[model samples]
Target chain A: MNKLLRAGFSRLGRSCVFWLLTSFSAALAIFMCAVCFKNMNAHGDAVDAGQLMLNYSTLTGVVTAIFASIYIGVDYSDGTVRNKIASGHRRFDIYLSNLTVTTAAGLFSYVVFIITVAAVGIPLFGSIIMPLPRLFALLGCIFAAASAYSGIFTFITMSASSRTVSAALSLLCALALIMAALTCLGVLEQEKEILSGSVTDGESGEVEFVYSPNPRYPTESERKLYKTLLDINPAGQMLQLAGRAEPDFKLIPLCALSEFVAFTALGAFIFRRKDLR
Target chain B: MEYVLETNKLTKMYKHSAALSGLTMHVPKGSIYGFVGRNGAGKTTLIRIVCGLQSPTSGDYTLFGRSGGDRAIVRSRRRVGAVVETPSVYRDMTARENLRQQYRILGLPTFDGIDEILRLVGLEDTGKKKARNFSLGMRQRLGIAVALCGDPDLLLLDEPTNGLDPQGIVDIRELILRLNRERSTTVLVSSHILDELSKLATHYGFIDDGRIVREMSAEELDAECRKCARVEVTDAKALARTLDSMGIEYRILSDTTADVFAKINVSQLSSALSSSGCELLTVTERDESLESFYISLVGGGRHE
Candidate 1:
């Protein structure tokens, strides 16, 4: 197991893609911080720098997911998995090693992105603060999203033989989940009405008809379907945590934690028994 | 006298096709065992199964006296190296790095013997060049070097010279002989190149349709396939009598034809035949090459 870990690390260490993604995420976070600072100065008001930093961290989770999928998908496409099996490494070990590397890379990118956002945002937009529990919960959400994405992407990469097909399917599946979540939350219908120019201001011209959709008030069957979609969609849970107007974040972290464990177990189970060749 | 590998009714099926059906073979220790077969004869399948790359559908095998199902079998397999099909190598890694990766996989203490292994495979000067840039023959040599990582006593080479040039073939042939003769490594090499195999194999196993049709030691094969004088005689009884009186060994095919195993003085035999009232009609000396012998064993060549 130690040897397997070392081999995994060695491969990951030499991968130019891993470092490239990390640097890109850090640079993007810095850019996002600068944008938030510019907006705050234009408005002539103090900005919550930590909020912008957290937004960058949230984006890091999504980017890490994309990177993990591509990294693992390329190996499957090139038939390297077959060579690894032929070389006497157990199938489980190979899968685990790849998963570990991708997960670690994702987590590393998330950390760097978080640090860069915080470093630039706190000084430029004023000292933004968070309670200890809220900070821990936010970190939990980021880690959970990364872990779940790792599992889902690994499963996708192994199951599909072609990298293009895998990438397409991964993106399609992610979009489908987000679309389904928005429909369940009644957000899509409201957006559709707004886009079609049907939404209008009242007599006071206060934009009282501005729509906010929430599936929390759904029919029992729709609620059940929404719950099922939410259960599998890591991105849905992430958006729920990051985009909530109210700061109620405890359940989001707990949900993310459950997802992390469930997806990891599922990925490992399928990977161990898969015929690599 | 102990055999290094013994299989009892080993069988494997891929989907609806039977790749290896009841293949039972024994390879003795310290012998260059040639696994002879035509293409698609299950040579690679058998080697893959034994190397733990694939599972056999049924039956069992023992390596170094350890049964295939035993944990010790996997442990013993560590001492058995194989190059099945095309070489299994990372084309991006240099020869030295390739060996280093293998050593790491095997959990060797250090890369102390890597230089020696490279020299043994004639790849010592490959320097930092990756295997992808190597020629087919060079890749094959590096594959052998990967197999030699742990100094395995048993080496399984499947068609090692399959696509090499004549000189490259000779180099591999010489290397296999040197490995066997000097290091006493037991080799089980599979090849359709019967003549090349004949040069290296101390024992031969002829496989057809996934089963070993024949297995014989070199000396037994030699005697069975020895060249002899084939003569046609007018009188079989008289010819037999004359040969018996002269203390020669021969086999009479019919009243007209017989094979003379010993080299005979044609004039003396002619005089003997004349005294015995037998007429010698024709004399054709024939030696059976490995190709012809293999064809005879497996029926006419599949091509013919």
Candidate 2:
């Protein structure tokens, strides 16, 4: 297993996709920081350092999906995976090594994002107003979310028989998760009641506000389900990390860890049975 | 003889068809074993299963001394190298980098023999060019170079000469012969080109419909496909009678043709046939080729 990891990392080091994606991540983070700096100057308002730092999480899921799929997919497409297997490396080791490399890649990009946010963001925006404990907790959740993204995409790419199919499925899965999370956030953010404009009082001809129930408001059971959905999905966790709403730091990490383990196990199972040409 | 690989009743079934059904064969150590079969006759399937790329649905094989069901089979596989169907190479990497990657995978002590291996495969001069830019023959050689890593004892090459020009084919053949002679590497090469296989194989396994129709040594195949004298005459019966008086073994193929399995004196045969009033038309020496033998074994068609 260590040998497999060493080889995997060596390959990962030379991978053009890894370097390109890492550069892209850093560039995107810097661009976002500049945009925030410009906004701060125009509006004369302090930006939240934690929010800006975690902002990269919103796109990390998609980026990790692309990187993980293409990174692992090349092995199958180029038939290099046969070397490892024919060399007597265990299938589980190959799967885990790939998962570890991709997870590390995802975290590497996030680290760059954080570094960019600190270097450019601290001077432009004031220091993070969020408490240190809360900030650390959110950072851990984001890391876990990134790991989950890697695990899921690794599973898809490893189980898929072809490179193209794996890449397409992984990208589609990432997009689908984001859309589902957005729907959950939308439903969870509904107001119980809204002011439906003004009505004139019949006696004094005075204007009065009228209240009506928000039809989209979820029931108690629905709220719990939606909240759970937000806590479990990596994209949903990213939405919370980006300060769309308060995050369940404990539950999100726990769910993300479970996803990592479960996907790794399932992926190993499928890959072990796959017949290669 | 010690067999490096032995399969017993090995079977592999795809979704709706059996790729290998109770197929069994043996590859002797220090021998170039030719795996002969038509297309989709389970040549690659068997190779894949042996290389651990796929698994047998039933039955099992023993590699080195370890059974397929045993955990030690993994360790045994470490001594085996293979290029199945096509060369397995990283197109994005240079020849050296690809060898480095394989060395890393095998957990070799260091990149010690990488240069030597590249030189052996004739890729030492391909400095920094990626495998993607390599021509077909170059890529194939690189694949063999990668397989040569760790100095594997058993080398499995499935159709190693496919898609090669005449010169390319000769290069691969010489390489295989050199490896076998110098390193004593037991090779199992599956190919549709019987003529090429005949040039290198010390042993042969003919497969048809997923089962081995026959397995024999080169000497055994030679004996089976005997040398004969094809004789044409006015009447084969008359010629046979004259040849019978001479105590010669022969098979009459037609009224005017017979394959004599023994040496005959042309002058004596002509005089004897003339006395018997059976005119001798022609006498030509013939030897059955590997292709003809394979066709005879499995019945004939467009082989590939």
Candidate 3:
């Protein structure tokens, strides 16, 4: 057990540089969010601070996912995975050690981002802070997102032939997920429909404008569809939290937790069966 | 005496191709067992199986009388160190750091004997020098140092002298000899360099196409490789009669040439031949080298 822990710690220690860089980037993003919030307040604009914070957090999540891919991907690219196995480490231990290091780094980066956001928000927003339980719940959602993303990215890293391919695929997957979520929410449906019509007509056609008043709540069927989609789409829950007038801490975090478990288990299963060579 | 390592019809197949096909061998305790085979002859596969890096597909091996499938096989393997194909060392770490990491993996209590191991592999002075910057020979030495970490009694080295210079080869050769002679470490050394193996091997197992073609002791190999005098005589029958009378071992090669195993006085041999109605034409002494003997044993094209 001590040997296992020592091995885990050694792997974690080697990735300290990644943690440092992540913290620095999170700090920069938090600073930018503060400046954006301050500029909007100074202009007396009714800006959604929560949404801005969510965007900033999402950016950090994306960057952390990329970092995880590179960190674990390098060993696979360099034939070190085979070497470690040859040195008598069990496959489970190798996967678990890498997972532990990635988790620690992700949590470290998330904590740094959370602290910076809180430190900036309390001063500028006049201490109108979210409740501690709610904040912890929100951070739990963020941690789940990070863990699930890292797990999926770890699988990608192991399966990829090169670091470049792994990084590209990770970025592509993250972008595809975000874009798919936006498309599913009907944000791009009208524009897409118009483009399809134009291509069918063999000419560039103009889209007609249709104005509708903002509804106070979604229809029952639409709400049911959103819940069903959230169950399958982990990122959708983050969007739902960002779009809500009041944070639905219970629903969003529960969905995130389940997705986290599912993806992590899937990743572990895929990694355990892979041949090191 | 119990064999330190034994394979019972071990076979391994990769997908549709068979890498090892029923290879059976035995290495006696405290003996320098030379594993001789050509390139791609399942030497590394066999070593990997014994080292627990791989599993045999259709057979079993026993280490220290413990079968590979038994629970005690791991304990038996704990006493074995191997350098298969290439020396496994972290190029980013220093020699000491590499050893330390290996010690950690092995769960050793402390770094007590690390210094002595370094000195044993001639890397004692490589302080603070990372393996990446070390010369190939130094890296190879560091690999041996890592293998020595657990103080294993059985050492498996596969093609240790593959890429070494003459001096580097000699250095590794001397190190292996000293370890076996002084520490009584049983070594299973695989090499294509038959001449070099002949210098160190107490016993030999010749593998060809993933099968053991022969196994012999040093004395037996020497007896098989005896030196003889090749003599050309005008009358082969007369020369044979003379050799029969003198009780000398000789084989007739052709109408004019024959080989005699026993040494003889040149003048007396000529006089005997003359008296026997045969004229001595030419004589040349020849001794078989290990390489030639191996080539003859396995056949020439097979070695190629």
Output the number of the DockQ-best candidate.
2
Off by over 4 Å in 2: A200-206, B230-262, B266-286, B301-304
Off by over 4 Å in 1: A43-89, A126-128, A158-217, A244-277, B231-267, B270-283, B300-304
Better of 2 and 3 by DockQ: 2
lDDT of 2 by residue, B1-304 (tens): 8999999999999988999999999999999999999999999999999889999999899999899888778899999999987789999999999999899899997999999988888899999999999999999999999999999999999899988999999999999999999999999999988889989999999998889999999988876678999999999999999989999988899999999988889999999999999999999999987778889999987555
Which should have the higher TM-score, number 1 or number 3? 1
Residue A251, candidate 1: how far off, in angstroms? Answer: 6.4
Tens-digit lDDT string for candidate 3 (A69-118): 77777665533454455445565666666766776776776666656665
- lDDT by residue for model 2 (A66-114), tens: 8988889989888989988988888888888999999999999889888
Candidate 2 docks at the CAPRI level of medium
Error of 2 at B45 (Å): 0.2
For model 1, the interface Cα RMSD in angstroms equals 3.4
User: Which segments of candidate 3 are over 4 A away from where they belong?
Assistant: A37-41, A44-88, A119-128, A158-179, A185-230, A233-277, B230-262, B266-285, B302-304
Candidate 1's residue-wise lDDT over A1-277, tens digit each? 5666676676567566788888987898888877767777788766665555456543544465466666777566434454455445665676677778777888888788778877877777656666656666767776776677766766676567577887777676666656765564453122322322245456656543444444345655756676656544666665555653232355555665676566666766776544333
Q: Clashes in model 3: which pairs?
A: none
lDDT of 3 at A262: 66
Tell me how each candidate scores on DockQ against the true complex: 0.29, 0.75, 0.21
Q: For every model shown, what is its TM-score relative to the native structure?
A: 0.83, 0.92, 0.77
**Each candidate: what lDDT?**
0.75, 0.91, 0.73
Which candidate leads in lDDT? Answer: 2
Docking class of 1: acceptable
Query: What fraction of the real A-B contacts shows up in model 2?
Result: 0.79
Which run of 10 residues does model 2 chain A get worst, by summed lDDT? A45-54
